[model samples]
Target: MIKKLFLLVILCSLQVAVAQELSCTVIVNSDQVNQTNKQIFKTLEKSLNDYVNQTKWTNRTFSVKERIECSMMITINKYENSAFSGTIQVQSNRPVFNSTYQSPVFNYQDKRFTFNYVEFAPLYFNPNVFESNLTSVITYYVYIILGIDADTFVKEGGTPYFKQAQNIVNLSQGSGYAGWQQTDGNRTRWELVDNLLSNTFKEYRLALYNYHRLGLDNLVDNASLAKQSIAGSMKLFDKLNNVRPNSFVLQAFFDAKSEEIANVFSDGPKVDIVKLKETLNEIAPLYSDTWSRIKY
Candidate 1:
């Protein structure tokens, strides 16, 4: 009996050890001319870190710890033609637990552009509606990083961050009538624009947060809600595509989501309970993989 007990304890210990966590960072590089916008990148970095660490999961599901392997740097690069770009480099130790391990290294470089607040300003100034408007931004970008459409994420029942975002958006709706903005700091205030400018890039900031918080913790439970959020995110991507047909980010989202959806159908039809369960497990990895590639 004692030997059996010892074996059980050992097995438990192994399970705990298998559930390790990972950490990484982003570095943005640009020219001195772009230095003024550096803070935006920095803020985004901090937000990503926060999402990966604190967001709680539902039903005591997967929980990720933020064990920083090293400091992350964002560099700004400039060209003679008056062009500027941003590059992000992430370094981290892999998290291994229960035969599950992830060592994700993401590197991508792209031109830097700013999203004007005027396009969405009317909703931004309202305290109640702010989160939803913010959700719109993040939802749009998370799919872009994943090579999926904002509509896709919403359709898949997007992460918890979507609900939180909706709360903000709902709160902001009627509050703008009184010219009552400035509930937050200056940078946030400025992000709340309403005009012809596109919000495609701004979505990345929100996507990172949603991925970190929701992906790590598994805070969402109701599958229906999750699907709606994912669909909403996909719709935002569609909107971006309408404005900029062949944008790099939009293309990426389309490719990723299309692959993911295709993969779900590739395994064959689900005709029985056993087959359905098997298919569900197989499709689960697609969700994780899609979210993992997201730039935040």
Candidate 2:
């Protein structure tokens, strides 16, 4: 029994030493690429998965169960020589407290991804320098996912991670990458991080903490009070919408949250849905159809 305990302690220590923060699944869809050989795509999918899941992106320790759950769907719409153009759908979710339910924290699609990749090339991330487009782009989203997840637990706790993503954006500004520049379009990586760190959009960050920590996490204990807190958190967006109407982060929040929000109030112990729906509509007018369905 003593020997078994010693072995278990050693195993736990080993896991602590090697536990990376992200549990990412990567899928590279190259159906649009007219390549006959499919070995390269398979290699890319594995490389990306290994790269993201193996890299220790932060100083914080995460057990296997605590690692952030996320996925990157890389759809290569065009490929020629070593150049590849694609869109990446990045998503992440956090487990609600006292329940098995996983709440969607981020669901965003980056459309301006264009990178060059050689099969079997090693992917490495450096904070101070602009690595290749493939490395930088994926790293940016990784930090964004980490940042938003942190924000859900603590007010503006994601600042450090968001700043890491900002560093990548600043370093990659002139690298000719489509998503790293201001002119890369409104939905580029540059804009996303900028908006996140900018003081003008702090409400969205605070609301994230309130919604999860103060609301969803308490649902099992007090469903009605939790729904009220969630509604109160949603009202924060109304203030943000008035200051910066129809912002990217606002849209990003609803993109992940609309369905969940609708369902949360629809079947709960009950709250003022009329006011909650108004707040939802005010902040995310695009999700009006979703808001209209919220009852009780």
- Maximum-lDDT candidate: 2
Provide backbone clash counts, one per model.
63, 0
Clashing pairs in 2: none
Q: Report the lDDT tens digits of candidate 2 across residue range 1-296.
A: 99999999999999977899988899999999889998988998999999999988889988888888899999999998889998999999998999989899999999888898899988887778877899999999999999999999989999999999999999999887788888867877888999999999988888899899999999999888888888888888888889999899999999999999988988948787778877888888888998888765
TM-score of 1: 0.28
Error of 1 at 58 (Å): 4.8
Q: Per-residue CA lDDT of candidate 1, range 1-296, in tens?
A: 99999999998776555432323343444444435545554554456444433332122333235332322344544423323233333233222222233323122222222222222123222323343333233322222222211222232233342344334433544433211134533213122221112245545334423332233222134333433333334444444445654444433333334344333333333223333233323333335454333321
Superposed by TM-score, candidate 2 places the C-alpha of residue 292 at a distance from the truth, in angstroms, of 2.2
Q: Evaluate all candidate structures by whole-model CA lDDT and list the values in order.
A: 0.34, 0.90
Distance from true location, Cα of 115 in model 2, Å: 0.7
Regions more than 4 Å wrong, model 1:
1-24, 30-51, 57-60, 63-161, 171-252, 255-296
Let me know the TM-score candidate 2 reaches against the reference structure. 0.97
lDDT of 2: 0.90
